[model samples]
Target: MDAAALTLHDMTAADVDEVAAIESRVQSFPWTRKNFADGLAAGYRGWVVRRMGAMLGFALVMDAPDMAHLLVIGVRPDAQRQGVGERLLRRCIDHCRQAGLPALTLEVRPSNERAIAFYRRHGFAQVGLRRGYYPATQGREDAWIMTLALAADAA
Candidate 1:
């Protein structure tokens, strides 16, 4: 599918089941539907990408007084490599820019090379690491803390 033409909409409670389903399929550690509910309750900014009546991806970012945190982003397996993730990520960046935030940050499992590479391509830089940041199959794993500094005129 040409993701470029996909419509992006604000995520709602009715979309939680489908979003959680996609997260479970793509992530080793997926967010539960309750997590989505709590995020929405706490007023996080969330968006869904859909086209031809199909859900392609979803992203939720939390805005702080100074920065934006990319809490979660998930794209369905069939939608992988179709630019859905990029479109979702661009939304995060734009949110930070509009809020006058200096940067957008995220934590990614070091093992997720695909995601790390994708963020790097989108101008994220690794700034630090957090021990036991993510739940691993066996125990826990560290996460790379990445930040994308937003220039006022940045694309």
Candidate 2:
């Protein structure tokens, strides 16, 4: 399906099950349902991408005073490469820009080349690396910290 057919909207508590399912299918170490609940409780910006009444993906963003962080983003495995991820990312970026944030940051597992490439394509630059940032099958793995500066005219 085309990404244009999907609608992006704020996620609700009822979406936890579907969102967790997508998260689990897309990642080796997925966030638990409790994680989503905690994010909601903390008033994070959590969004969902849906089409034909079915969820395609979701994203969670946490905003600080001067900066915003993409806490998590995932698309259902079957929806990969359909532009849903980009749409979700664009929404988060717009939110940060509208909030007058200086930048948006995220950490990606170094092994996730696809996500690294995607973020780089969307103007994120490698700022640093975190040692043992993500759990791995054998051991902990490092993550690349990336940031995208919000343009004055952004959003």
Candidate 3:
């Protein structure tokens, strides 16, 4: 689907169930509902991407003075490779830019090649790795730390 066809809106408390369901389906080790709830309660910037009333994906971003961190991002299994993830990511990037954040960062499972490629395509580069950062059925998984610097002129 065309990325332009999707609309992104700030996530509200009412969207927790739908967002959690999609998150669970998209990841083997999804965040619990409480995680999202607490993030919202803590004033993190959360957004949902939708098309024709259907939720395509969601993203959660935590803002700091110097940088913004993407705490979580997910696209429905059926919606993978459809540009929904990019739309959600762009929304976060825009938010950081508007908030005057100099950089944005996120961690992804080292084994998730598709996600790694996606972030790379969006100008994020692998800057580090976190050993055993994610839980997995076998045990734990490492994560690649990716970062993007937003240019002031670009915004």
Task: Tell me the alpha-carbon RMSD of every candidate.
Answer: 1.2, 1.0, 1.3
lDDT tens digits by residue: candidate 2, 76-129:
888889989999999999899889998999999988999999999999999999
RMSD of 2: 1.0
lDDT score, candidate 1: 0.92
- True-structure RMSD for candidate 3: 1.3
Itemize residue pairs with steric clashes in candidate 1. none
lDDT of 3 at 52: 89
Runs of candidate 1 exceeding 4 Å displacement: 152-155
> What TM-score would every model get versus the actual structure?
0.95, 0.96, 0.95
Error of 1 at 115 (Å): 0.4
User: Highest TM-score among the candidates is held by which one?
Assistant: 2
The whole-model lDDT of each prediction reads 0.92, 0.92, 0.91
The residue-by-residue lDDT of candidate 1 on 34-127, one tens digit each, is 9998999899999999988789899999999989999999999888998899989988888888899999999999999999999999989999
